[model samples]
Target: MVDQRLPLASVSDFATWEPVLRLMLTDGTHRSAGRSARVAGRVSRYGWSLGHQGSLSSTRIAVEDIQRSLARGGVQEVAFSAEIQPDGRTTLGLVWPSPVVEPAVGYPDLGVLVLAEGSLPEPWLRRPDPVPGAMPAPSADLELLERTLRERLPDAIGATEEEISAAEARLGVPLSDELKVLYRVTRVGRGDDFEAADRAGEAVGCELFGLEHLSAVDAAQRHPGWKLGAKRAVRTGPGAAVQGLAGSPGWTCFGSNGGDEFAVDLTPGPAGHVGQIILVDHEQSLGAELVADSLTDFVLGRLREDGGDRRGDQLPAEARVGTGHLETIQAAAHPALEVLSVGPGDGTPYSLAPVAGLPRLRTLTASPGTLADALEVAGLPGLEFLELGAREWRVLLDAGAVPRTLKAAAITVRDERHLPVVPLANEILTLWNRPRIVQTLLYGDLGPGV
Candidate 1:
């Protein structure tokens, strides 16, 4: 067991600064050393002798690295054991109780941060090689798949062996040969153009999450009190309890259309085959079901099939008016239309009124300019999902017009520059208040934000 108590602190210092230190360590927003130094400086102000007042350089450096590692977004919790040297220097040994972020190279479980009295000694760093693991050889099928995908998407490039190894370490799971090959070839981050038809003739798009997404997802899964949202249940037998994977433990999601995913199962259930490809659908009554025997078959099948008609393209001509006309939405009385997307016909913002015509519309996706109009005019009696821009989200909040029937919402930000000037805390609090919406996704950064 690691000793959590900070060493060489007075009782007063312990009482006053321990909680602050813990908060600084666990808070995910402090990514840089400067931020960590600020927190350490605050602690020093609270009666702890971080070092001499005018010469706290060594203490600051050690504290900064410790806090930076702890604040790393994907880290769940950090534990530390501190040794107080006879000469008043301290060596703090650190470990992540459960790391969602991949540890820096050469440090697996242990890191060392040394603080000497009066001035700095050595700079803070991870101790080398605490734990080691074997690396798997890449398979031929994965190589072939990479070559094929690159042929189709000229810009596609595979992840390096080092990248793959890092991902596996972060995930704490071995990647199958198929996945190894795929990642090596194409590290897809934003996949809007990859479209395919599933066996059911549904127009499925593919956005195989890159390593970053995987790390984020892993962190969320490990977060305290996190639950799978709006997942469909699966039953194995007559008396068996229904099982629902908010996201399956053994399944690694490789690609997703809006509503469904193609995942590779590492641990097969009683009815499932190990290493089989499966389709996990949020809209399906059964939730997850088998799709193909292998990754090769799944890839080849999607490639061979013709892209099916998209639901958005099937709307009546009147419903598909050019973006300038908000009046068209109110006028078109299409009772049974299920999905609708509205964008500017011209580059200028398009305004809409509440559309009462499409009472049966289940899904609505619109640009920020048109969202207010859509919300105000749409009766949305059967609405299930909504997609809108970040600016539109603010509009809805201001109007307080989100429909009660909405099950999920995807709020897209085209670029980080478009993010509201509001603090992240306030933004999160507002979203948390919307309990009726079971799931919410904020996507898009234009490569500027994480």
Candidate 2:
């Protein structure tokens, strides 16, 4: 049934790819590359990028055709490969999206999804821990905030008691006194696009959402991919003002600044107020920035702001080695570590013994040839997500050392030859009895280049 949803036009048709191949061969490398050229690129609803191809003007039509085909097939992301033999014979390979491929439209690509369809990353499954030390900020004044709003916008209508109760019921969390008082002053009915924008800008620093628009900023609101989520851990520093979490149920969204949300933080950080405000940016996958100490501060032009750099070197829970964040695996090793990412470096492969048996470590990513011993991965018992080069994955597959604890995995493509990536991914998926990556290949001859 999944196959039925694919491009109705034959993906195996040589004609479908002939235009692109002809244009690719026009890149002035016909005598060298086109004579036996190998071309590859990823295309999807987002965009398309193909190297070793002709000018954009010449390739635009062909690229558009492929994208339209993907749209018809309802594919979010797809990669294609074309291998042209010296004899002019061409092999076109199309790697289609599957259930486990991760349908991420707007969410961040934190990591590649290697598990069954329903399995979410650890961060997406976390809830806000109780913050016993959190209390109301000193600036939180329900009386002042309401009085100021009423004076600033005397003509503005306010929400009824029933509307406030409805929002509380919908969010499953009671609004803080500051939040209740602020909303009571104005329910913010949508007045036309321009007027609504003006009203929100004048009332709040951002576009304020009405009572009906108030929603809970919870984990389900965000769907981060495996690469980033599995490679980073959510953590707040010792004196953080807002807890470092992917999302929280207690975060009641009230406004938006384009790609960010303004919320009341009920579960605040160690040095924060329970009724403080936080800004959750879309570009980030984890944690909120302390935008205002309290709603009163946020409204009365006394807003206090600070950056969320307390997590220190991208948070203690996540450690990246060899990619310039940290120098060695020894430096990255910590008892609280959860995500270990090893990137390509100039030096020789690093040993994994430093991170061996790390209690909380669950996710790992190692670039090609970056590990001195691929089999050392067996020592990480808590690994739930993994990504390694094809050769490294093969070593694990052949030695029967692949981590049994892995819920999902990926084979990092080292070069343009994606021909091996899917097969390796399928091999790993089969270990867990999951569906394999669907591949289609077409053969043709573009003929000797002009």
Candidate 3:
């Protein structure tokens, strides 16, 4: 006999309370568990409790809370006994002696377990049909993928409903519920399975774009004659954007890696199913290959490809490659690359320097001569840290060539006495005087005019 005494104000309060039993199981190597619908019907004659609200009665549990708790994975199977408060709010308490269960296993003892005194038999309780497409109701595979991503990538965030709607409206197509739920749970960027550094230390794989990127792509596609490499122009005519979105065999891009993109095929192919994902390489003019059947499957399948534990965080922080190797440097560029060393070697210097091609380059280490050659080129938008010879730094400052994006610099001054004093505007001075600038190391000794 379980403790059934309630600190209720009246017998009516006790009568309003109800017991919602849900069977959960720990699966895979991690042993994570959430609500399982498989045993919902078998546990009791009353079908399954679907929503956060435990039942039609006042007793309930908020579905959002359950998702938050299960997001990181720890709590296993536990029974939630819901009681109605005097103010009409539902308060759920954990039941003792949680049913140790496996998937598809039936526990007969749960049918006879008493939640509260005078509780009626399971057959007497009301059972409602499960609501479909509820929030935080992701499948087991998606749930595990979400957990893995959250653990690996600290910057990942769930998208708001407004963000999702805006992205769909801009794309002129209805995003699948799976994709929406994925974005709602995790706005893609640099995730463990998504970004891996190649031989040149460049990030490879699908770089998942956010709503902002989608907006930019939308605007770019609308311009006349705008095209991606040799591929057909993105539909820009009135109503043409979404005309073939449903059944037409076309690629709809959602994310990109500067030149290539991760796209979804709207219509099915001979071997490919509808809504299948593929990698479209625009730069190489290469055709796409089937990646996954669905958006969720694509992400989960990628994570599973590396034995479920491949993390981009484990990659090296910096990469050093020979100078003038544009293809080599581009191949190695990844979101994780913070420092890049480009220098002169056996290869001929490119007429157009390759440093600007790296999307996430922060610190650039190059010979003063090498840096001078690339002064005309642009595209190091994320560069913040710089390392160069003092003479080269002075040359850039004299020519006003220093990018405003540079925050910290390390000048290797062989002779401080030879350092030139260049006139700088207040705006440039302010940037040079910033706190990060103070930390800049001026290597070698300084000589005073004596």
| lDDT winner | 2
Q: Point out where model 1 deviates above 4 Å.
A: 1-140, 190-205, 215-234, 237-246, 283-287, 302-450
Clashes of each: 10, 9, 7
Stretch of 10 with least lDDT, candidate 1 = 120-129
What tens digits encode model 1's per-residue C-alpha lDDT throughout 22-118?
3433443423432211122112111222212333554454344434433443333332323222232322333333211121122111111111111
TM-score of 3: 0.26
lDDT (C-alpha) at residue 404 in model 3: 71
Q: How good is model 1 by TM-score?
A: 0.29
Q: Write the per-residue lDDT of candidate 2 for residues 1-450, one digit (tens) a residue.
A: 113334546444678778777776676554474346667666566566666535666767776777777677776766677778777788777777777675333321212546666776788888888877678988888788888887777767777899899889988889998878877877885453567546755876677888888887867556566655676677776688888888888998888887799999999877778988888888777888888888898887776646453567664678788856788899889898898889877777989999999998999889888999999999999999988888998999999999988877866664535566667777777888877777677778876553
Clashing pairs in 3: 54-60, 200-332, 201-332, 202-332, 202-333, 203-333, 203-334
Each prediction's TM-score against the native?
A: 0.29, 0.85, 0.26
* Comparing 2 and 3 on TM-score, the stronger one: 2
Kindly list the per-residue Cα lDDT of model 3 for residues 1-450, writing each as its tens digit: 123442222211322222222212111221123311111112111222332323333222323333333333333322233322222233333222222111112321121111122322111121211222222213325555455555544454677899888877876766665556556655654432434212101211355665445421122222111011111211112211112111122356766656756665553333334455655544322234455556656655542222111112212335555644433555446665556665665554433244456565655666545544555334577655455555566566667677776533444322221112111111234444531111011111111110
Candidate 3 Cα errors over 4 Å, as ranges: 1-141, 188-205, 215-250, 284-287, 301-450
Candidate lDDT (C-alpha), each: 0.41, 0.76, 0.38
